[model samples]
Target: MSVSQTSGTDAVDLAIIRELSRNARISLAELGRRVSLSRPAVAERVRRLEDSGVIKGYGVHLDLDRLGLGLRAHVSLRPRLRSARKPQVLRDRLLAMGHVLSCVHVTGENCYELTIAVRDAQHLEQVIEQLSEMGDTTTGVVLSEPVHPRDVDIAAWLLCED
Candidate 1:
């Protein structure tokens, strides 16, 4: 596999990105007006951004509680043996599970960390049991989440000169 290199982004491109990040569904005319560009100019730039893989895609943020998934837990797995085969198999099994939202190969004492959401304690327990069957797992149920931002300040990081 080859990685494609992207051309350097200018101030105007950054401004356009900031505007789009604020509201992805904003009309091209409105966005161009905010960024002091014409609609066609903005459209062409957005098309380039998408083609160059700068703008991957757009997404919607949904509330887990509203979707009847109240219980959230973090499961840390420690493999019995440090073999490549068992770890890969365990990861594939976790990926197949519906309750496992995110699985991260992490550093430290644990091999993998999984973010899971379920309807209730019984459901969470079932997930835990399934995970335990694959390997030794330690689960921490989330009591509360203080901050979970959907969008981050990518413009600031991108603008900073290295």
Candidate 2:
């Protein structure tokens, strides 16, 4: 189920998610072993999680450099009133571009923040040009990712029985 402010997600569901996030490739048997459930039981749980929209599809983490996309950048964009490019229009445009990894509508000065992967500086410039059509953009190259994706904060979301 959706872990909204109202809907209460079970701790077991949280644990299952934590393990799955760590390794989505984990076999049902192994996952069951770790979570102290039978294979079928765990399978049922995972199925529910998926059906409930808690578990999305599994995907591989790609090494972009090996894939020929060496440059990674975050392009902050704010829509210009002079153009037909509003936030929704910009989102559609960004989604259509192959290099755009993620385009999230955010709070504050910028309307959108885009995570982009490209071949090089030249490629980044071309992408920036596309973004500029939609809005004013400030590009920042991601030099390092000190802390990346990890498990969700358990205490923050998971309400206790006590």
Candidate 3:
């Protein structure tokens, strides 16, 4: 039988995802009991979720500061010339930089928003110089982050009625 037959897009899937999101190491038998499915069924569904790219992979969220990464900066960059080609080239270069954790193409005056984690001011300055070579960038160092949600609302995203 298809994996969906064992566990399809129903409340069961949501429960499995929620449980897995909380602790990816949870045993299949425990997950089965929580989601009202057999252990084998739960395993099949989880496998399918992985294959489908829904459950990408499990990872440990680290404390960057504890790991000696003392600086977090959000950089807004404006391309020297507004063109599709320029942004792609700039993005490629930014992605190669070790300090850049994430780079997102965004709207507004800036073409890209980069989330950079670095050792200190000197490292941050080097990253800024590299990015600024292609485009102008405004860097804002993070002072404090009160909250950052680890889990996304999967049910809301999956079952949007609109």
Best by TM-score: 2
TM-score of each: 0.80, 0.83, 0.78
User: What is the number of backbone collisions in each predicted candidate, taken in the order shown?
Assistant: 0, 0, 0
The ten-residue window of minimal lDDT in model 1 covers 1-10
The residue-level lDDT of candidate 2 at 104 comes to 81
Clashing pairs in 2: none
**Model 2 segments more than 4 A misplaced:** 1-6, 81-88, 150-162
Task: Provide the global lDDT of candidate 1 against the true structure.
Answer: 0.80
Per-residue lDDT of 1-162 in model 2, one digit per residue for the tens? 344334445666677877888888999999999889999988999999899877879898889999999999999988785443465766666778779998788899987788999999999999999878777899999998887765455433554424
Candidate 1 at residue 126, lDDT? 91
Runs off by more than 4 Å, candidate 3? 1-8, 81-88, 156-162
- Stretches of candidate 1 off by over 4 Å are 1-7, 81-91
Residue pair clashes in candidate 1: none
Q: Residue-wise lDDT of candidate 3 within 1-162, one digit each (tens)?
A: 433344356667877888888888889999999989999999999998899887899988789999889899999988785552375766667667777878788778887888999889998998889878777889999997876656575654555533
Distance from true location, Cα of 3 in model 2, Å: 6.6
